[model samples]
Target: MGKKLLNKPLSTRVISLNNSQIKGIKHKKKKSKKGGPIPVKELVPKSSALFFQYNTQLGPPYHILMDTNFINISLKNKLDIFKGLMDCLYAKVNCYITECVMGEIEKLGNKFRIALRIAKDPRFERITCLHKGIYADDCLVNRVQQHKCYIIATCDKDLKRRIRKIAGVPIIGVANHRFTVEGMPDAFGAPKM
Candidate 1:
């Protein structure tokens, strides 16, 4: 038999969690209800988490290009887009409206009166106003190009087509309680790409 290694010793490093840290960690674990650090294999499945991680790390800041029709439909539907926009503003996302579009929304009268009221609201005081000339679709296109905004939200089909043609900017349309983003045209007469 080999000689016993009775003289061997294990090294120790001291560490301790403060009361607040321990409490916070416990609280989080309780609230999450899925005990302790989840094993890598048991956390979000690899494929789904990889896509989410890519978006979190590489997605552009949300910048919504707006028009009168977007505001009108959002108001009519009582959708949360307005609130979402407000949250984006709070988070420093660029939200801009041109003077002509503002005027158009205001002129909508009963058709979009509520949206007009909301636009004048103090809660949205931080939204930026861009003063481009009236009847200047080119100017609007220029703004979209300059900012490289991720999406343009509107409700006017003709205007949506026009914008797509002029700026090549992606458009999100809201109509009759539904909203859809433009994609390349497909065989079913759908807007694709």
Candidate 2:
């Protein structure tokens, strides 16, 4: 025979529910009649560091771009008047030369030599020739507008007018170490400086 068993399995059992068990069951509460709670306004505090960070990424303003007539004067004088202008630019602003202007200078035959001499100088930086389709005058105007603040150093009357109409900034030339802002009269008048 087998050893006596300690516990016997029940074949059938009866179960009953308690009062707490029946009362604990509940239905979810109905949603509010006023749709939902009003949305709250989120507050975002501003920081000075963020303002300065954005300003630093913007960099400095752009420099003036010169035309052929100015380059011719610089070459004729052999005084590096361009360099002097560039020195002024360095102090108060920056200086730029367009490839179209460079090409025009190169076409000046012997005068191109003078331009080349100045090109080697560190003060002058050539503006890349991306929009080669635009004429030199138009290109200069566009650059000025893009920079928002700049003067065109040129003596061409028509070019001066175009620049004024397009850029709204004064076109100036340096003479006797002084800058003269070219007006409508000077646009038609002979080159002063």
Candidate 3:
């Protein structure tokens, strides 16, 4: 056992220590060649269509991205999707459903059969998702970030909260037998409150 222990080399690296290291004090950090500390400029690119947080691209024929829960809530409220959207926004609305959201609804089994039927309606355009997994919220958030032209419709509180953080994107939800929009200016038919 003694000879076996002596045969093994030391695993720890031998680092020569100076007076600063022995005193438990770090040496002065090397400054940049520019002279002072590097200034961090975190520049977030703003969309050209955004005029001081208001999206100018929004107009008649609004494009809305629909989530599974939003469809479920709308059906539960007994509101017609087309008629309700027209009444609320006073515009021709185009509803979009993503493949992930469709997969999520389909996975919910027969309990949400009616929602599945509504999602299959010819009026709603289906958006294909190439990414893996069927997590609708991440897929929706990513799509919204890439294209700022969509107004997300979701009854889920978590989804609503996530959408609110992205500037120039609006959220539509069912309330009081109608659709209420958030993050949109008053001129765009957002709720008064």
| Top-scoring candidate (TM-score) | 3
For each candidate, give its TM-score against the true structure: 0.48, 0.52, 0.77
Query: Residue-wise lDDT of candidate 2 within 125-152, one digit each (tens)?
Result: 7788788463678888767656545567
Q: Model 2 scores what on Cα lDDT?
A: 0.59
How much is 151 displaced in model 2, in angstroms? 1.6
Best by lDDT: 3
For all predictions, the C-alpha RMSD in Å is 18.8, 20.5, 16.1
**Local accuracy by lDDT, each model:** 0.53, 0.59, 0.87
Better-scoring candidate (lDDT), 2 or 3 = 3
The sequence of per-residue lDDT tens digits that candidate 1 reaches over residues 151-189 is 566776666666665333556665456555554121122
Off by over 4 Å in 2: 1-62, 77-79, 82-90, 174-178, 182-193
Tens-place lDDT per residue, model 3, 1-193, is 6686667776633335754556785678767798897667798787887888888888879999999988999998998988888877888899999999999999999999999999999999999998999999999999988888998999899998888888899899887777888886653347776
Candidates, ranked, TM-score: 3, 2, 1
Candidate 1's clash total is: 6
Clashing pairs in 3: none
Off by over 4 Å in 1: 1-60, 83-94, 122-132, 136-138, 166-168, 183-193
Candidate 3 or 1, higher lDDT:
3
Checking candidate 2 for backbone clashes, the offending pairs are none
